[model samples]
Target: MHFAIVGAGFTGAVLANELAKAGHNVTVYEIRPHVAGNCYSERDEKTGILLHKYGPHIFHTDNEEVWNYVNQFTDFMPYVNRVKTTSQGNVYSLPINLLTINQYFGKTLSPKEANDFIKSLADGEIDEPQTFEEQAMKFVGKDLYEAFFKGYTLKQWGRSPKELPASILKRLPVRFNYDDNYFNHKYQGMPKNGYTPIVERLLDHANITLHLNTPFSSENKVSVDHVFYTGPIDAWFNYNAGRLGYRTLDFVREDHEGDYQGCAVMNYADEKVPYTRISEHKHFSPWEEQERTVIFKEYSRKCEEGDIPYYPIRLVNEKTMLNAYIGKAKKEKNVSFMGRLGTYRYLDMDVTIAEALDASRKTLDCVNKNKPIPVFFVNPL
Candidate 1:
């Protein structure tokens, strides 16, 4: 079977690799000069630091299958994302742990004392949270919410917390203990050689052909057994409905003589700070040592026509548009939409890989049964 995959990112690359291994001819078209999509990482020629081209992507997931699968392509270095934040002229650890609670209040409270204190601060009136503001207030109360979340949320999403969904803040933890680890995952690490090499290795096969800096469209559609599209779902149909809302990021790069922030990520809780956080690239790979350091101050805004979409803003309007696109996609022939962009969701690397593997297995099953390939292996909505 012959397959044409659009966008040589994790989804496309994984699918291409899986299908190629099963004796299928795969052709990958990537508009960008490089692969790996938002997970793209490369070394800076001047500083000699391996910079995460987009931003810091800490590979953390409890899924054992994804953990083992990724290990096959590249060796992952042990890395844990410990984030720091600045609020009201004070530096604090993130996730609002015991240490942060103590530092913020200037009191040495035990875990039980801290928990009870937070409960006292919490808005006992509100039984259920309907918005991000309500959720935060109920969880950690006004002072902590305003200090840490309010300004940052406004800057990151370009919207008020009251207007956003409660689910956004639900993922954030308010720890009683002194654990500052950002994620609670069984497997957490970064690819030693970087993510680009992983995708390159995936596409590096006898049955797979790579096309760099190529824009794939309906015109580029060829006589193939199936098409696996990892590009924007709206763009695939030429935005017949409307563009889905997404937040794009602009990175301000800086080079310093020595250690900059002394951490991988530092979130600015104040709205006065233009950028959300300043990430020191060298700190991401603590195993490697370098004299100079590189950092990127990340600024978030509504995704423009040509800007690379970083995070999907799944607001009501965006979801409506997405559903329309999904409806159109379901009726399409010999095509399978997979990945974050295609599904119109913000997916971690592990979830993306797991879905791609599932899609590939399903595709092979369909071929064996002489059935038409599905429009989506997993529901987009």
Candidate 2:
């Protein structure tokens, strides 16, 4: 069978690889010149630093199967993202650990002491927390929320934390212990040769043909047995309902003589700081030594028509718009939606690969049984 895969990112690349391996012809159409979507990484010509073009992407997942699958493509170096955030001219460890708590308050606090202190500071009156601000106040109290989350959340999302959902703040941890690792996943690493090579290798197959700088529109649609769209769902339908909300990033590239931030990611939690975070690219690849370091000061804003969408702003209004698109997608024949943009969700790289693998397996199974392909392998909403 022949498959028309849209957007040569992880979703399309992974599915293309899977189907190609099964002796099916796959044609991948990538609107961007690059194959890896947001995870595109390349070495700097002058600095020799492996730069994450879009932003910093740390591959971390508890799913052993997904880890092993990515390992097949490229060698992954052991990397733990120990994030640091600056608030009110002070730097502190991320994930709100005991060390952070003690440092912020200027007191040596034990795990138990810190836990009790935070609970006491929490708003006990608000039994049921509703918004992001409420959830943060309930978990880490007013002080921590205002200092760390309030400004950062507002800058990142371009809205007040009170307007955001509680689920957003829930993803951020408030730890009593001193563990400062950003993610709790068992498998955490960055690709040795960078993310682009891994994705390029995934699409490199006898049965697969890739077309870069090719936009897959209704006018230029290909004749294939099935279509796997990794692009935005609303865009596929020509934005009939409305443009879903998304937060796009503008990276201000900088070169330094020595170490810049001394960490992979240094987040600016102060609203006074224009950019949200500054990521040192060389720190991402610690195994390779580069005297010249490169960094990106990331600024987030509302995604426009031609802007590259980074994070999905899945607020109430966006959800309504997404649901309408999903309804239209379900009615389409021989087409399936998967990945962050297609499903209209904020998904990690691991989750995207896992879903792509699952979608491919299900697709192949249905083909063998002469059953119709599913509209969506996973629920969008």
Candidate 3:
């Protein structure tokens, strides 16, 4: 069977590779001139540093199978995502660890006592959290939430925490211990060369062809036996129910001599600061050394027409629009929508690959047994 993958992100590239390996021809269509989508990385000529074209993406997951799968393409270096934050002109550690708690309160309390004190700070009257603000207040109290999450969340989503759903805030960790690791996944590392090479590896097969700067639509969907669309689901149906809500990021690049920010990521917790976070590219790959460094002050805002959508603002209205798109997708024929934009859910790199692998495996099985393909691989939609 021949497959046309709509976007060359991890979901499309991995599935393309998997299906191609199983005796199928695949062509990946990407509007962007490059592959790997948001995770694309390239070398900076002046500083010779690998720049994360979109933002920093730390590969962290507990799944050994995922770790080995990526390792087959490129060697990963030990990279710990130790994030720092500045709130109200005060600098502190992230994930609300012991150091942050002690520094914020101007006291050196033990981990256990710190945990208890935080529990004390929480509003006891609030039994159930219905919004992001409520969830933050319940978990870490008002002070921490205000200092760390409130302004950032507002800037990231372009909405007050009260207007957002509780599930959005649940992704953040409120640790009572000294563990300051941004992600709790057992396997954490970064691609030694960059994510671009890993993606290049996935598309290096002879049977696979890549068509960059291609805007795919339903008109071109007839050649392939099945379709794996990683583009926006609403766009697939020509926005019949209007566009979904998404937040796009604008990166303000600044070049500096020596180390900048002293860490990989620095969250600007104050509302006055326009950008939510500033990422120092050099710190991501510690093994490399360069006198000059570069940083991207990330400004999040509502995605305008023709803007690169970074994160989806899945508010009530957005969800309603998404459901309408999903309904249209259900009625469609010979196309399987997968990945974040396809399913209208926020997915990390690991989960996207896992789902794509499963999808490819099932697709292969169906062809062998002469069965029809599915509309979706994962059922989060």
Candidate 4:
């Protein structure tokens, strides 16, 4: 069977590779000139430092299958993401570890002592928290919430914490121990070269054809047995239902003589600060050495037309519109919606690849059994 893949990101690339390996003709369309989508990385002309064009993406996953799958393409260097945040005019470790707690409160407390102290600070009145503010207050109390989360959340989402859901805060961890590793995944590292090469290898199958700078739309006519779309769901239907809300990012790049922030990522948790975080690209790949460095200051705002969508704002309004699009997608024939944008969810790199692999397996099974392909392999909601 012939397969048409929209967008050359990880999802489309993985699907194309799998189908091609099955002796099916696969064609991939990428609107961007480059592959890998947001994970695209390249070396700076002057500094010779590898820069993540969109933002820093650390490959961290507890899934052993995902770790082994990506390893087949490129060598991964040993790298753990240790993030820092500047809040209240002081630098502190992120994830609100024991060190941050002690430094902020001016007390050297043991793990047990710190846990009890934080519990005392937490508001006991809120039995069941609904909003982000309530969740933070119930978890770490008002002091830490205001100093660490409030200002930064407002800047990143462009909305007050009270307006957001508690589920957003649930993803962030507050550890009593001094472990500052950003993620708790078993496997964590960056590609030895860059993500682009890994994706290039994924699409290098003999039966796969890649078309860069080619946009896919419902209007375009294609002679494929099936279509796998990884673009925004609303875009597939031309936003007939309504546009789903998303927060887009703006990156401001700057060059420096030596190390910039002395870290891969340093987030600014102060509302007064214009940018949320500063990422020093050279620091990302510690295996390589460079005299010069490059940094990108990140700012977030409401996504507009033609802007690349980063985080999906799955508020009440967006959920309603997303359901409508999902309905339309299900009614379509010979089409499957996959990936973060298609499903309208914030997906990690590992989850994205895992889902793609599962979708490919399901597709192959359906084809072999002479059954109809599923519109969605996994539930979006």
The 0-to-1 C-alpha lDDT of every candidate, in the order given, reads: 0.92, 0.91, 0.89, 0.93
> Candidate 1: global Cα-lDDT?
0.92
Report backbone clashes per prediction.
0, 0, 0, 0
Q: What TM-score would you give candidate 2 relative to the actual structure?
A: 0.98
The best candidate by lDDT is 4
Supply candidate 4's per-residue lDDT for 153. 95
Candidate 1 residue pairs in clash (backbone atoms < 3 Å): none
RMSD vs true structure, all candidates: 1.0, 1.0, 1.1, 0.9
Worst lDDT 10-window in candidate 4? 216-225
- For model 1, residues 1-381, the per-residue Cα lDDT tens digits are 999999889999999999999999998999999988989999899988998898888899999999999999899999989999999999999988999999999999999999999999999998889899999998899999999999999999999999998988765588989999999899999999789899989999999999999998676675676788998999988898989999999999988999988999999999999999999999988999999998899999999999999899898898888889988998988888889998898899999999999989988898999988888878776
Lowest-lDDT window of 10 residues in candidate 3? 169-178
By TM-score, is 3 or 4 better? 4
**Tens digits of per-residue lDDT for model 2 on 220-315?**
455787888999999999898989999999999888889988999999999999999999989999998888888899999999989999889898
Tens digit of per-residue lDDT, candidate 4, span 89-135: 89999889999999999999999999999999999999989999999
Clashing pairs in 3: none
Query: Runs in model 2 with CA error above 4 Å?
Result: 219-222
lDDT per residue for candidate 3 within 208-290, as digits (tens), equals: 99999998866678777788899888888888899998899899999999988889999999888999999999999999988
> Model 2 residue 363 lDDT?
92
Off by over 4 Å in 4: 218-221
CA shift at 295, candidate 4, in angstroms? Answer: 0.7
Candidate 1: residue 255 lDDT (0-100): 86
